[model samples]
Target: MTEEDIATASGLPVYTWRRRHGADFRARVPVINPRERLRLYDAAQATAYIKGAPIPASPADDAAHPDDLLSDKEAGVVLGIDATTVRAYATTGYLPPGTERHGRTWWTRRSITVRRDSPDQRHHSPGRQPGDLRDRAPRHRRDPRVTEVSALLLLGQVTTDEIAEHYQVGRRTAQRLLAAALTVSED
Candidate 1:
């Protein structure tokens, strides 16, 4: 398994795991991909090791982002907060640092998820009280960006890749948004 895979299984950052138990863990497992520093561990052994490890302060809630990457909005969705809150968290170090590429902030979903699932989140959660109408209601309105992307797609003037680059979503999300918009228009 790769370092990332081990991280996913253990619910800890690879670096944190290494810092805590690197020597022992490495001695127990054989390195298969030296370039990636990946170690080979079968499923059963990996599961047992993961179960035995101490839970990190930041632990992944679920295996949500396999690629370990996400746009701010995507991270927000996973974090049960808004994009603005996500940015704030990133700025305050509540969330992991992100890279700004092409005017968009890209974060590690693993880190965001860890923060989300971590107990520390309760202290820093946004001020949304119980019985908030916005939280209870369904947001029937489509995202404006999705609508705009769909229009550009229907015009056939912009490629899907361009839409993905512009919108900071995956090609599949772009396609689905376009398809949904087209369906709505047809209706």
Candidate 2:
């Protein structure tokens, strides 16, 4: 089949498929036979094909008990804090110590659930209290790096960490700066 015929049959942009496969594309199209193509189209019409579907919990899949450790991200979601905050809490020894294995750290999912459910639990708490000590910071202590970095990025100049390093601050601080800047810009 001609290049035009191949493009029409495959429903791909002619230039892209041709550039990708080169001359071999022409030879393979006839070998695969257009029957498979038609079958694929029919399948597309009959059922939706989803990529990366979450595995359904089966009868054999037991609910993770309260003692099960979770990842920092999962714990953060349960505690309603950002992933960075969760990491910070872990670093500060606020959260129950997690175990490192397979190059990853995991918290007990059970421990998280218990902390979340307990009235006396104190780790990974979200939201600033009314009497938060951070409120005592002077107005001059406010960092403007996130704003500058985000503005520069929007203008296609610098990246997130570039701005952070420029100000000698952590990347998370830079990100928070950007988020705050975006919020203000949106308002």
Candidate 3:
């Protein structure tokens, strides 16, 4: 049963079970289904834990190898990928699901190795392809008006009023274009 199940079965208030006994209960009970999000515990073991009695020792034969467990970061180091990517793969079923215990997620060594050695694990950088960068210019786009204004002002051939008349624009627009031209030319 779950924590709520154990609490309700033992006649403890929900909040009391959570705020008071939650950590203690978790510490005492080993979840039976580690691969699943919903944690499940043996009914007898849950009862034993709830009664404040010593829980029986489970079978040692069914236990995982002590050195087989690895955290996601450790798995990432093994796979040469970022920990977040490792976690993403796990969640996306590219890797085996991890077990959460004591607020840490762990994956088995075998599962990580299987993913690491898989045929499709090798990746290539998606390099430049035909028509890949048709419009990707190296520099920011500059206004043609600004360039023309800059050249005319540099040649001392036109005033802002002349620019306004030539470009058929407002006085404020001429002033702005002239200012933009000055800044662009200075740069």
Best by TM-score: 3
Candidate 1 structure lDDT: 0.67
- Using all chains and alpha carbons, the TM-scores for the candidates as numbered come to 0.31, 0.32, 0.34
The better candidate by TM-score, 1 or 3, is: 3
Q: What lDDT score goes with residue 142 in model 1? A: 76
For residues 98-130, write the lDDT of model 2, one tens digit per residue.
887435677888767765777754544565777
* Model 1 C-alpha lDDT per residue in residues 1-187, reported as the tens digit of each score: 4555777677788788778876776666544334332234444455556677542232234534454556677788888889899898888777877986445677876677667777865466566778888788686877787668667756776666776788789999877776776776676
For residues 1-187, what per-residue lDDT tens digits would candidate 3 score against the true structure? Answer: 6677887987988788888888887787787767656676777688888777889875354454544567777789889999999998877677877887546678888888777887774243244665777546788777799999988878886678988999999999999899999998798
RMSD in Å for model 3: 8.7
Higher-ranked by TM-score: 2 or 3: 3
Candidate 2 TM-score, true structure as reference: 0.32
Count clashing pairs, candidate 2: 9
Better TM-score candidate (1, 2): 2
